[model samples]
Target: MDYDVVIVGASIGGCTAAILYGRAGLRVALLEKHRNIGTAKRLCGHFLLGRAQAPLQRLGLWDDMVATGAGTGDLSIRTEYGWTDRSRVDAPPFLNVRRTTLDPILRGRAAASGVDLLLGRTVTGQLTEGRRVTGVRARLLDGTEETHTGRLVVGADGYRSKVASLAGVPERFTPNGRAFFYTYYRNVRHTLPTPAVVWWNDRDWVVLGPTDGGLTEVAVMPAKDTLPPDLTDHAAYIERYVASLPDAPDLTRAERAAKVVIAPDYPLIRRHPVPAPGLALIGDAALTADPTPAPGCTWALLSGQWLADATAPALLAGDDPAAALRRYRRAHRAIEREHAFMRGDAEAGPPSAVQRLLREAAVHDPEVSRRLALVGMQVAPTTSLLNPALAARALLVRHRSRRRSAGRAGHAPAV
Candidate 1:
């Protein structure tokens, strides 16, 4: 084997994996197709939720990330009901950084850890011994072919992962159910302080993410079918949509800091038969979700850490990596599957009965609001809201709030 581990795609997941593997004294090769090496993904705003706190702290990535003028603050969500009280929710702040700026930091850290950084190499095929994926064949920028073998091959490539295909990892996909659009707007001075806000409108969800370079990202995810006929005029429609949002930003005055990117919908895929013999998958290769909740970058980094945490020692100890790989797979499924189900329930239609109860309760009860914020910020699992005690509390709060409103209505002054 040319290396202990060969990682394809040098995004957050692949780079972090390479860093950890190399830090563990393992021979690692990190390959990316982008020759520039600082290229960033364009789909989402690339914010890291509270779930990222532990992983970033463990990997020691947050400080350097923050030092690079990355924005960090508690996320504020405003449903039709009302805004989540930012003061009451004390969870860790979300990390907001532009990928164009953040990618190099990861690359630097990965390089510093002694990982072989292979740029501009597109994986065309994978090598196999019997049924195990043992390596990858690649084509260079100059059209030169290169073959590299490793004890394990990791597919950290994005949503359209060629590595997964070559390793025969079949993908099970579902529609995101909403069309997405986002762009950075300059001079977006919100009332709040560097706040990350998501406003859920009647049929659309809008998020105003304030990130580096003093720019605010306004992203909208609306029902896929509700799109206007002339979707070509994205700027016009997007501006119209922004104006309709609650306390909307003045997009007409704000200059677009970036290009307007639109997607019909992203496919949701949580890998089914991954962790194949001598192969593993991380980041979007293993699972992908719509940008509605913006879980991509966080999951990518966490999955990389989890994979490295699980397999490094075993690889060094010369033990079968299956056990460690199994551990990683279970962890990934437990969290990602739960989150996916929650997202599915949400996007299937309007809020479900339980969702209604939670949202209503989040507005009334401080504790529920905090927990809900935690869940929304990805600090707590979505299932945490499913606790019987918590559900009862939410119901009780909603019930009391309704009663109080009814009483107030009955005693209201005549107009």
Candidate 2:
């Protein structure tokens, strides 16, 4: 094999995987289609939540990321009812950095850690041996084709991954029902409880946050079929809708930093069994859920770390890659199951009678609000969100509230 591991794509997930393997002294080939290092994908929001902090700290890049002058602020979520308003919450919150700035930093760090950076290279196909992937075939910048073999090949190529299709890994599709248009702006006093701002306008949503270089990143997600025709005049569109919404003026007429970028076609899918005989997929390639749950850079980093842990022993032993691949698949599925639970709950909504009662209680009760936050954040298991004890408490609260209302109406409580 030319390399111990060949990673397709050189963005956050691919580069992070390379960094971990390279640190393990594995010969790694990191391939990127784009010529430039740190080339940013326009559509991403670049929000890194608190959970992903531990992995960066482990990789020794946490301080470096902070030094990069990424946007620092409070993280808050707004529903039609109101913002979760957690700026007062005591915790080291999320960071919003531009992909262009942060990706290059991560890629550079990976190369410095001894991963071969194959920039300006397009991977065209894989070398398979009857159900086992052996390596990849790629085209170089000068149009030269090369075949690189590796014990393990990682398809961190993202949502539209050719590797997943070519390797015969089937992905489970989830209709996003929506798409997004985003751009950067300046001179917006968009302060929040944390660096990230997530606004849920019923089913539609919008987010605005600071990225690298003090530019505020703005994105509006609407149902795919309902997008406005003229994105060139995005500000005018935003102004008409956001002006009346509470705390949304920051998004209406902010100074423009760049032209609007529209992603009216990114569908969400969750790929199952993220590994094969010699290949493993990570990041968006592994499992993609709705952005409403805020799975972005943080999830990518976390998944990359998972790939590293799963394959480290195999790389060390220089043995058949199947062992590593199996472990990788199992670990990836475990993480996916965790996210799957959240995704399922999101799709179902609070539909059951118990859930409806709890939601109504949460609207007025502080304790219920905390529990709601836990479920929304995926901090608690899906089952925990519907715990019998919690449900009983909610039912009790609902009963009390109804009795009080009836008393105010000068009528006996209805049976």
Candidate 3:
């Protein structure tokens, strides 16, 4: 039987697309290369922001997520000297969930939404006629090759997407200069004020949060070459660094929960036109960037819903594939460009002097702290930081603080 849409890679992105399309009455075949549909990657931070809430609510998965023992709360960011905690305002509360628990739940929901699950199938290549993609050639677990035809083929496969390569789409590349190391531990202490915290030192950073069942998820992000062989060495480095800061909490008492896992955190990239004619790519296959802007669950849900919204109308209009694909491409680029600008100069070292000054100011002022939180979350644009008025204010605050310290010393502080 021919499907309206055949999606490769049954990840959050693929599953989401399948759920959306199937619910719209389209027959969708969602393929997973893995033998088990319930499997999940071990190295995710497992934190979801407000933007991810829309898709979950739309798909009726919010309650189920909570039912599955996910933590619902605000996210907090910690820099060298302080913490900024912001609760959900006019958005769904952020969720703390292990990917192992989350992915399988989402996959089950996608199946219930009418997606045909084709687990243990490797999509080897694409079936394209000239510039128009028509179907896929996949090899099943039993060593049998099958051809599945579809009006539209959605490539939701990850970073190394074969479908995108087969379609001859211009490859989008991201800078993978940093690596992330993480592990989950049980009975870990949450002595920090918030469940989620980002500790920024001069040259390194760590993001930690509580997962299900008293397990704490610790993620260490450092330059690819900077981290010690064990990654745990950075834990000691963080302790020494944090102790020097004013009012920093003691983390030495917290027991190490699990062995560290390390992976690269790359720069963001997007293909200008994700879908052309008869093929479309969604999620990481379509666009991906560093996790700094926190792109896991939100990116998946947004891209998935986007593909569904863009193509459902065309499919209903009798296989108007080209028009639908064009719409999908346009929508993807629009969102990608916006995210690219706000993700910050990740290439730059730690926080800038100016940023540090503003953060110091935020410690005393709630509004300033909230703005800082927005910046950290990448919810606000970079222009906010570069604004002349804000930059001047940060400078003034910094200068005055230096003057006060100098006066106490009975001399000007050396710059």
Candidate 4:
């Protein structure tokens, strides 16, 4: 084997995994199809929430990221009714940096950690022996084909992963029933001091975040049924939508920093066979949920770290690699499954009565708001909100609010 591990993508997950493996004294080949490893993805909000900070710090890149003009601020979510202020959580503020700036830092760290960073190469096929994947055949930009063998092959590619397909991994997808459109703006003043602000208006969702290089990212996800006829004219549509928000900044006052990018649809894709003999998957290649919540990047970073931690000992000891891979598969599924369920429920339909009650309760209850914030930041499991104590408090608050409304209306409260 030419290396201990071969990763198919150079995005956050792949690069992070490569760095860890390399640091563990194993040979790693980090392959990227793009000519430049630092190329910014066309359609990413590029906001790294509080959960990602620890990983960045562990990689010794947190200070570098901060030095590269990363901004930190609280998170605010506004609904049709009102805003949910979650800045009281003890967690660190979200890190907002452009992919253009962040990716280079990650790639540079991976390279420094002794990873064989291979850019401008596309993985054409996998090398397999019986049921085990052994390596990959890649073609460079110059049309030169090279084969790199490895003990394990990891697919950290995005949603449409070729590795997952070639590895025969089974996948199931649920349409999120919405499309995302976003663009960057320079010199636009925002209403909130937070790094990111999410507005939920009449079933439509909009996100605004300040990223590196003095640019503010404005993204929108409109329901499928409400999609505009001129989808191709993204700028016009984005402008109109942003302007229509109650307290949104005027896009006309700022210079359009980038071309508008649209993801026509976001389907929740889950790869069933996450691990097989000598093969594993991470990032979007493993599971993808609705991007409306902006958990993709954080999950990507965490998945890479988890996989590396689980497999490093086995890979270093020359033991049965399947054991480590299996552990990774189990952990990945558990963490991702919970997140997927929550994300699916949020996107499946409008908020249910209980969900609305919780949201309203969060506005008035500090503990409930903190719990909601923790879940939103991916620092706590979704089940935390459903604890018996919290549920009872929420119910009590809901009952009181209803009773108060009835009293003001000069009517008796219902039983």
Question: Residue 222 of model 2: what lDDT?
Answer: 65
Lowest-scoring 10 consecutive residues by lDDT in candidate 1? 339-348
* TM-scores, all models, native as reference: 0.94, 0.86, 0.86, 0.93
Error of 4 at 17 (Å): 0.4
**Clash totals, every prediction:** 0, 8, 2, 0
Q: Can you tell me which runs of candidate 1 are displaced by over 4 Å?
A: 346-348, 411-415
- CA lDDT of 45 in candidate 1? 67
Who wins the TM-score comparison? 1
Between 3 and 4, whose TM-score is larger? 4
For residues 6-29, write the lDDT of model 1, one tens digit per residue: 999998899989989999999998
lDDT of 4 at 359: 80
lDDT, candidate 2, 259-360, per-residue tens: 777665655677754456778888888777666456656667878888888888878897785666677677666557667664553443334555556556
Give the alpha carbon lDDT tens digit for every residue of 1-415 in model 4. 3988999999989988999999999999999999886786666777787888898889888888888777677777776656764646665678888888888888989999999999998999999999999999899988989999988899988899889888888888887877888888989876674667877776678988877787888888887778857567888888899899877889888899888877887788888534568888888888786777777888888889988999999999988788888778777876676656656564646877766767877766667778878877778888787788998898787678678889999998885
Over 241-320, each residue of candidate 3 has an lDDT whose tens digit, in order, gives 54554444555656666555656556566654455567888877777757655665677778888889988888867766
Question: How accurate locally, in lDDT, is each candidate?
Answer: 0.81, 0.72, 0.71, 0.82
Candidate 1 residue-wise lDDT at 119:
87
Q: What is the lDDT of residue 368 in candidate 4?
A: 75
Top model number, lDDT: 4
Question: Sorted by lDDT, highest first, which candidate order results?
Answer: 4, 1, 2, 3
